[model samples]
Target: MNTLNEINWFPGHMKKALDQIKERLKTCDGVIEIGDSRAPISSFPTYLDKLVADKAKFYIFSKADLADRNALEKHLDKYTALGINTLALNLTDRRAMQTLINRLSLVRTRQEERFLKLGFPAPSKRFLVLGIPNVGKSTLINSLAKKKKAAVENKPGKTRSESLIKVSDKVFIIDTPGILEPNYEDKNIVIKLAILGSIRNDILPLIPLTDYLLEYLLKHYPQRIYERYHVSLDGNCEEIYLRIAKERNFVSKNQSDSERARSTLLTEFRNGLLGGISLDE
Candidate 1:
């Protein structure tokens, strides 16, 4: 994981995209910042405030369906209390999203009207939906349009370009490619989120991350593991992993323990099979 200051993961294309965002910021009225709900603070780009300096901003905690409801509520409250207009959303909830879209439109309209009275042409009320890779920006676009207007996949870096999608007559979304801060140094937060699938799991080492997640689940979401895999959590993390492996019949014919059990458990937990769990809380 890379920290914002020590980010070494920014590719050439991402640098170009960052340049484009800076250029396009002049034409846009505000920004819609999207982040993973489960790890809101960690997943949010630390440099976003500086990048969008003084711009009207709204925060969307995406994948709210997979987050603890209480945690989500508290996150919303915390952000809102800071005077940031915030929303927690499950991409599948169209009715609730309609309301969100409406609110965004109203905000844009208000901004546009204020600009109009100054005798300048109405600024295009553009919203840049920005987040780290795989934070579900594309899925949010699809959900808002009620169709597949943008490509969406479980993999990271799926949407690698900026796109404009109109959700209503007044609201337009500028979808940017996901950006990763270079070489994040916050190993613990990174590992936790990777296990949650909030970060790209493919790029990370599964065994160590899975081990960390196993320990975490044992302490925080013990019932979730027991309920999902029918494993007793009365033992150590390695024992728990072995129990899950035995239950799922994940074994090597060589009579040795297979690491597949750990991988499977990690994947299931990431995909929310263990329920809507939040790693941070």
Candidate 2:
């Protein structure tokens, strides 16, 4: 992998998005911070610490279907201890929609006092969906609305601007572009984000990222590699990737197609074919 400082993770639009968020935040009553359940901590932006300090923040661990129950429970316990309300959700599940509505309803009640103290009558509750790319910020909006109000795609940074959607008469949502800081302070967090598909695959080299994923999977989920491709948890990451490549016949024309194998491994891992693994433990 290249040095973390060398890679330009943030683009111009993301910076503009941050400014837009701060400007738009003034009208919002609370924030629904979406994070990948597979990597809750890393996916949650640190810049939001001060940004959401005064706002009612509800943390949602999105895509729980791809995470381990044990790891998810552990993260839930940690956040609960901190007094932050959190919900683990699979956006495809209809029940999760109702669960979110009920939770946000409670959040509105909790924040009403804060609003009243500010010399204002409690008005409609507005929530901005904030998270890194491809963490389902838009998907949550679409799910809640039960219609395609916001564009839904399986790519990061698809939401380039904020669009309002009315989920209920009193509840509103703003879907914004995934906000990553202009710079990455820690490379491991970047790798974690890349591994979880929050960042686009093209931003980084495939082999290095795949190598990191290999190490990460072996550490956090040893059995998954064997289960999916019959590749045992053995040898270094490159050797393991090579082994899988050879096993899957990724080689042809007298040369091994390591790139194709890497893509396959990453896609399967992202698609949850490697079992329910969590990188945020």
Candidate 3:
């Protein structure tokens, strides 16, 4: 198994985002930590456990539609058992957005009651939605606002600044730009996997990462491999990628099959064509 140590990716803006988050933490009531459902462990920032220790916190497994449903359910069960208020939400779903709002309301009410018990004046409930780039934070906000207020894109680093939006009379959301870890050697691999759209099959140019994903998928979810692309597993990762290339009719100018078969496979995999596959599962 190739550990994710080879990939190196980190932007300078992440440090700025972290500083801004720290500056604004005092004004906020709690944090809504958003994580990619496909790779929750990788998507989460380890520093958050201490960063938001003084403030209330909630975890939202975002992009639930693309992740393995069973895996997500298991995660939810495990996290909930540990007393973490976790919610599995598909950001594109309107009803799921409503449910999330209601859950946030309940959490706020409980916190308000606790503060009241302590003889502290009840503060207005403010939540900051924090996540890495391209984890669907803006889309989630758009769903909640019921309008196209936040800029959303499939690419990473789209939201470069923080923007506060009022969702309701009692609930307000502070939308922060996606923050990536700085020089943290451990998470570099996971960041590259996410940028390559290893979670689903919408983006392309999937060469090295696609081969990695196929091998990983074949070893774990063989049934999904057979079901999605109708390819049998008889050989190694290279052979499987070639078989997919041949099946998809992606040929090069020299009458040779293009390497694009791997690219196409990756794109489809990221778009949920390979079924709701979760990398962490």
Candidate 4:
């Protein structure tokens, strides 16, 4: 797998966002941390978790519509066993918003109890919404708010400021800019993030990222590619992609367009055309 050394992922804005989030956490009563369901464990930043660990936290696996159900449960169970309120939900699911609200009500109730015991007036339940880029933070906010209250985009790093949104009468959400960890020593983790589109599209090359995704599916979810692309997984990744290109007539004069083929593969995976695949392994 490519180590993704060429990606200029951490911009000055993200560094500044981290500092701003640290300061903003001071006013929040809880945290609603989102992560991609395809690579839930990897996309959940350990550093950010450490920062919000003391707060009443709810861990959400967004884009559950694009992840393997079995693999998703495996990941969710890991967090649940740690006693963290964890849920796997696709933003489009109508029930997701209510389920989330139910879980958050617990956080609010706990906050109320805390304020009572501490002899402080209990204000509205305030939660800081945070996660890596492209993790559906904005979309989730819009869903919770029951309107287009937050600017939502499919790309990474779209939302850039901290804003307070009133989702319900008794609950408020602090929306923060998505930020990656300052250091990513694990290349595999970065690769998974890229594969899941959590990393910015321009930050990493699609060829290498798709190649890693190729090898991963070949190893763990070969049936997915076979069913979706009708391509055999009997050879190296290059050979497999070429086979797909050949089968789909994605070629020029009998030669596969490497760029086009890789892009197609990545787009298929990202769009869930390859079925519910997971990079949790």
Per-residue alpha-carbon lDDT of candidate 1 for residues 1-281, written as tens digits (9 for 90 to 100): 23323423466777877787788777777888887887787788776679887677888888887888887787788887897788888876777788788778767445687887998876657788888878888888888878888888887668777778888876788877787665566667667656656556555666777778888777887888778888678767677777777887777885425378888887777677787767676
Considering only N, C-alpha and C atoms within 3 Å, which residue pairs clash in candidate 3? Answer: 200-269, 200-270, 200-271, 201-267, 201-268, 201-269, 201-270, 201-271, 202-271
Listing every candidate in turn, what is its Cα RMSD in Å to the true structure after a full C-alpha superposition?
A: 3.1, 2.2, 3.3, 2.1
For candidate 4, write residues 1-281 as lDDT tens digits.
Answer: 44466666789999999999989988887888888888877898667867877788888898889999998998888888998888889986656788788777767546688787999977688899989988988888888877787787778888888678887667889788888876788878887887777777877777778888888888898787888778778878788888888877887776886667888888888999988877877
**Top-down TM-score ranking:** 2, 4, 1, 3
Q: What is the overall TM-score of model 3 with all chains considered together?
A: 0.87
Q: Could you tell me the lDDT of residue 54 within candidate 2?
A: 82
Q: After superposition, how far is residue 37 of candidate 4 from its true place, in Å?
A: 1.0
The alpha-carbon deviation from the true structure for residue 23 of candidate 2, after best TM-score superposition, in angstroms, is 0.9
Clash pairs of candidate 1?
1-184, 2-183, 2-184, 3-184, 3-185, 7-182, 8-182, 8-183, 9-182
- TM per prediction: 0.88, 0.93, 0.87, 0.92
* Clashes found in each candidate (C-alpha, N, C closer than 3 A): 9, 0, 9, 0
Taking all chains together, the TM-score of candidate 4 against the true structure is 0.92
Error of 1 at 174 (Å): 1.0
Better of 1 and 3 by TM-score: 1
List clashing residue pairs in candidate 4: none
* Global lDDT of model 3: 0.73
Which residue segments of model 4 deviate by more than 4 Å?
Answer: 1-3, 108-111, 118-122
lDDT (Cα atoms) of all candidates against the true structure = 0.75, 0.83, 0.73, 0.82
Off by over 4 Å in 2: 109-111, 114-122
Worst 10 residues of 2 by lDDT: 102-111
